[model samples]
Target: MRTSLSVHDLSFTWPDGSTVVTGLDLAIGPGRHGLVGLNGSGKSTLLKLVAGQLTPTTGTVTTAGTLAYLPQDPGSDPRRTIAEVLAIADTLAALSRMEAGDVRESDYDVIGDDWDIAERTAAELGRLGLGHLELDRTVATLSGGELVLLSLAALLLRRPAVLLLDEPTNNLDGEARARLIEAVAGWRGTLLVVSHDRALLNAMDDIAELRGGEVRWYGGGFDAYEAQVAAEQEAAERAVRAAETDVKAQKRDLVESQAKLASHARQGRARAARGDLPRILVGGRKRAAQVTAGRVTGVHQERLAGAASRLDEAEAAVRDDREIRVDLPDTAVPPRREVLLLEGVRPAFGDLELDLDVRGPERIGLTGRNGAGKTSLLRTITGELAPAGGRIEMKVPWRYLPQAMDLLVPELTVAENIARIAPDASETERRSRLARFLFRGRDADQPASTLSGGERLRATLASLLLAEPAPQLLLLDEPTNNLDLPSIRHLVEALRSYEGAFIVVSHDERFLDDLELTRRIQV
Candidate 1:
């Protein structure tokens, strides 16, 4: 079998001297491969190293053919035109000059063999649902989802043999996500994607998990990899149990051996004291008994140590899947309470009139296309943006968790950020509340700028729910964008205990299903 991408003894270290990956080797053949791990497991770093965006500290990355990379955040100049983003502006300009009969020899050279490049670019954009966008339009008018798809389209136009995408579905809506997944499913050559989106991962031919600075390969897609991991965990748990039992038995044997040795020593002392034989004979027996006792105790101690070592190894194999446990009784709204009422409400963005009467703790899933005004509706409801035309009557306190998660002050610690919302709470109280979200001790003191994607989300959630008024109605926008699988699960666990009414805008079908939403409203 031939490999399209290969890494040999690859190692990378930050300038701060912290190593992200070391002695890592991977071989990816011509197939779609999904890369998954925890938030800080270096999946993106590995992808960048392989794509030649970053130089490795040691070792090398070898690619069989041309490579194209779609980064997680494909930042672009807002003033750049669509044609420039698609990388066909020069060729299109050459074609334009030729059509006007003003083409120079350099224009002919620039056009090269891509005579139909404009047509091909248009078709590719149409396939990615960007047909409505004109080539001359600046990217400033496009939504976040549209920008992501445009970046992907640019990569596809290159038609490289090895493609690397890092969280390409972060801001996409359901429709856009489907288009991206379809493209991934039909991809030829070698494609490696770093994503937490289960739907996107399910389209891969294989799964590569980057954990503990190493890459482990598994056959098939996300479901298959999950099943395999679950089985391995079960076996590891059984091993731990068996080793624990062995340790306990060894401890019991050691105690019994010590007791028997003490009894034998006492008997020898008694016989010697009573002059049962000559002093010499008694002394000799006493010395022999002492030696035997020492040997027996040594044997038992060695056995116990061995058992303990084995138990440690067995326990190390088990994974820690601790969930975030929290209860927000104060946020609960009464079943008969009328939480919000929107009558003929039109947002500032798209022309979608929303008329909603949210009662009780209704969990609504908001669905829409890329350019739809779902976020605008949420902002209007939260009074962050005035509605273009109708009335919004909010009977209870409400809070909005924006997709960008800019609620926290970057300079403040996690606890200090929470303090901004809960000013009356003491430092101890703040930390105690933050601990429920898994920010314990030193974690609670971490600066907002230093947090990982998952940690930042958790901290933001903590700040919202722990506010002074205790928000009864919550609006969440794309809450699971860049979170890893465990973090997504943690979010689910936290939401399970939240009693408030929330409208979450997400493209993740699996995540929405897990929420057991009362209703789904398409914007």
Candidate 2:
């Protein structure tokens, strides 16, 4: 197979001298590849190195043909038009000038061979469910999910031989996600995508896992990769058990050897005390016995050390993926208690009208397309934005965890941030609660600015669930965005014990399924 992209001894380190990836080598052929790893495993950093967005500390990256990269944010000026963002504005303008009979040599040069660039761009946008979008439309007018799709459309229009996408399905709605998945499935070039979305990863031809600064390839998609890892983990656990047994046996042998040595020494002492032979003869026998005892003890000690080393290796082979565990009994509402009431509510953005009542510990999921007013309705409920019409009544204390995760104060530590929200919580209480969210000891003291995507989500969740007056009504918007697969599982585990009523805005169907949502509200 021809290698479309290759990395040789690639290494990268931050300005603070913290290493991300070291001595990493990878080769990608012409196929759709999925990159899976825990958060902070340097998946995005490696992609940036491959795309030449960041300089590698050492070694080189080689690409066989043109390359295009779509970063997690894919930031673009809000004022820029779709045409300009797509890199075809000049060609379109030149074509217009030629049509208007004001063509010049410079215009002809700008047009090049992409005379049908406009039609091609439109078709690409349509493929990604952006057919309604106009080239003259400003990016500011698009929703976050729409903007993401628009950026993808721009990339596909270029027809690059190598494409790198970081979390491409993050902000996309169900329809948009399906479209993107279809595009990925149909991609003919070498495509590498870093994503935690199981549906998206399942669309890949192969899976590449980055762990401990090394890349390991799996033969098939996400399910196949998971099966292989599961088998490996099972073997590792068995090895660990066997090693433990061996270590225990070695300890028993060493103890027996020591006991036997003590017995021999006592016998020698008794013989010498009885004057069974000349003093010289007795001394020589004692020395010989001592040497024999030393040799036997040495053999047992060597066996014990070897067993201990094997045990260590076996334990190290097993994965330690910790989970978040917490109890929120205080947040529970009575079966007949009305947690929230929305009466003919009309949000500020979309034209959808809603009348809903959340009672007791109901778990509700909000589903909609981009710009369909899901977030607007959430903001309206929080009173951050006044509803255009109708009334919102909250009978219990409520807290909102926005998609942006803006709850934390960057300069404050995780503990400090939690304290800011729950002032009545004692320091011990704060630390204990944060530990349940997997932030313990110095991790609780680290500044919020230093948190990875998963850590930040955990911190934000701890703040919300640990807040004073104990929120009985919770609102979460896109809670799983940018979180790794393990982080998402952790979030689900944390929520499993939550007894409060919640209405979550998310496009992740898998997450909603995990939550076992009682009702799905379409906005």
Candidate 3:
């Protein structure tokens, strides 16, 4: 197939005064393309530009055929069922053919009737793992992950020439994400995908990195790009060191030359006073030497300036444009035994039981089909929900980190929020604690709402830990959803080191496996 989508010098700025994407040029053909960058780098914005959901302020985006976008958050589209939603594309096509009367009698024999099309559409839904899903189930009732998968199925039904996906793996489990990726990889059409999953990027033909309102294309895998970035950083560090050394050497030479010039002037004055025979000649020589010394000083200054320029470039290169530092406050708590216990706890909501028994030191993974009450069960354990019939006992102080980072006040600055959370601590003490969590100086003044998803998570965790009574039990729901790989690793390390019990719900298999889960509770 030929290239289906092309974007040239595309730029967009929101009315609220943020240039999300600028001077971006991209050419997409038939192979899978990966869009990898830090959050708010405009990956989603670029996709929106291509899909025509957002207009560009400059340049143009052109598509040869039909286009579709599967948004990261497939907002509530409630009138369709899982199966009906997937079949909409086929239904639309069939209706068009009937209204146009373009299907001749002979064409009907070859193309099959409306019933045949509907039957095959239903079959296709089954292949995509929605076979059991009722054709009449409302989209509103599905979980966030289920909605994402269903949206993909709907996109496939349309059979567009180009597909733009924004974090399609957002709410999906390991298996679902893998299946969705495999299906897209096998697709014959063009694909542009935005994802933070490093493993997924390895399967792409090329990657595009967005930073500072610019997009850089790398014609290699994730590993190659990472290696290149690392080397650049090392080179930058060396340049900085060399610049510092040159500055010091230049300053020392300047000091020595000034001293000699001063001594020479003093000697000339002595010779004049003595009225020595060759005083004039000595003056001429001194004048010539002074000119030469001045030229040498200028040369040294120029060389120092050159060194500074190189150092600047090196600093830019070593900045590691995509790096994000997430720090959580250090919390000290007394050792505890049996943080939480659930004995044959059959928590039910509307006659449907969600979870069974759960114990401490046991890593319980909640997994099931959507609407199987995974989240409901977690809420019950965290006291967010009142269980109808189950018994839950808690022995230690606990803290809950919701999936949405809802605990953070959106309007408050990072430092102010921290101070508010720990009201007993002084400003200096609060700032010191926040500094350990990497919210230093001006950074602490940025409102929590403006923070990146990872940053918000870090700030939230830091505030929770800095409370008067640190939590001994940490309950996290979908902890790794929007976090980058490095942030996720840091969080895992922090949790591992804490002398506290943890219960987390996530769909990432590799994450779960890497953390060495003790046991899995299928809800």
Candidate 4:
């Protein structure tokens, strides 16, 4: 196979002597490869190095063809239009056409004799779903999702040999994400993608994992990688358990040896102190015994130290395999006739009717295409925005979990947040409530700012339950946005058991299917 790119003995160390990449080697020829790893695992760093944006500290990276990168967040000039950005990708092609002396006097009257190139760019734009966007409109007017779509369209228009994408599906809705994946899959060039999207990874030819500054290539796609990871994790766990057993045995043996050596030394000393033996002979024997005991003691100590080090290494492996848990409080929500009423709840935007009829004990899912105003409807339901011609009446307790997860106070301790959100509770009661939510002891003392994404969600749910009256209505907007697979699974399990009325807005098909919402409203 021809090598499009090669890296040999690639090693890099930050200024702090920490190895981010060491003795790493990779070779890729014209095919799709998916890179998967945990957050902060140097996936982005490696991509930057591959893009020639950063030089390797101690190794060489040589590329045979031109490379282009699309970052997770595209930085587009606000003053440029979609067409202009697309044209940027065709600069070389346009220049080549300009140099060919193909300009006709009549053709100049239309697209200045470059009408062919412009037409090609226009077609590419339409293919990528930016056909409606004005070519001269400022990029600032585009939403975050729109920016990503336009950026990918521009890069593909360039027609480079290799394409690099970082979390391209993160901000995209389901339809857009599907379209982007299809575009990449149809392309006949080398592609390296760093994403957590399982579906996208499954579309690749191979999967590679970056862990502890090293890479392991799997023969198949995401499923193969997952199996390999599971096997490795199981092996590591067994090693940890075995090491702990050996360490415990070693500790007991060391203690026994030390005690025996002390006993021997004492006997030797007593024999030397006796006047019954020839003085020289007694002294020599005592010295001999002492030397032997000292040697044995030193050996035992060395063995103990080795065992301790092995135990530490095993413990580290256990820590790495540990999964983050998301456990929320289980509150009592009384069965109500009508928790909230959204009658004729016309939204502030969009062409949809302001009429939405909902009753208690219903799990409703709001689904729609991108820019369908799902979030706007959510805001209106939460009373953050007043509808132009609708009414929302709450007959029972209610709370809203916005997509931002801003319910918890970042500056305060989790315990403090619980207390602040429920001021009528006593200190003991607040602590007890937090404990029930799996934030017991020192965990409760952690600042909300220090929580992981899953932990923050749990904290918010705990606070709501701790209120004087448990909320009968629960509204969640994209609650699974930043969660990992396991966290999402845990949330689905919890919601399955929840008794309150639920209304969720999400574009995740898997999540919605698992939720088994009773009603689907497309905005």
lDDT scores for all predictions? 0.88, 0.90, 0.71, 0.74
Local error of candidate 2 at residue 475 (angstroms): 1.0
Any runs in candidate 4 off by more than 4 Å, and if so which?
Answer: 1-29, 42-67, 73-85, 88-147, 171-175, 212-216, 262-280, 318-339, 354-364, 383-388, 394-502, 513-523
Per-residue lDDT for 388-446 in model 4, tens only?
67778877778888766788888898999988878988988788767655677887887
Which regions of candidate 2 are displaced past 4 Å? 57-59, 411-413, 423-428
Cα distance off (Å), candidate 1, residue 517? 1.6
Q: Model 2 residue 488 lDDT?
A: 91
| Model 1 score (lDDT) | 0.88
TM-score of 1: 0.92
Question: Distance (Å) between predicted and true CA of 261, model 3?
Answer: 4.9
Question: RMSD per prediction, one decimal?
Answer: 2.4, 2.1, 5.0, 6.8
lDDT of candidate 2 at residue 61, scale 0 to 100? 100
- Model 1, 192-253: lDDT tens per residue? 99999888899999899988898899899999999999999999999999999999999999
Off by over 4 Å in 3: 1-3, 8-19, 52-59, 77-80, 87-120, 234-283, 321-330, 347-373, 407-452, 459-463, 466-470, 493-499, 513-523
TM-score of structure candidate 2: 0.94
The TM-score ranking, best first, is 2, 1, 3, 4
Residue range 453-493, candidate 2, lDDT tens digits: 77788899899899988999889998898788988998887
Q: Model 1 off-target regions past 4 Å?
A: 8-19, 49-65
Q: Kindly list the per-residue Cα lDDT of model 3 for residues 153-247, writing each as its tens digit.
A: 77876678988988778767666767776777687778888876766677777787776777777777677777876786787788889877877
Clashes by residue pair, model 1 = none
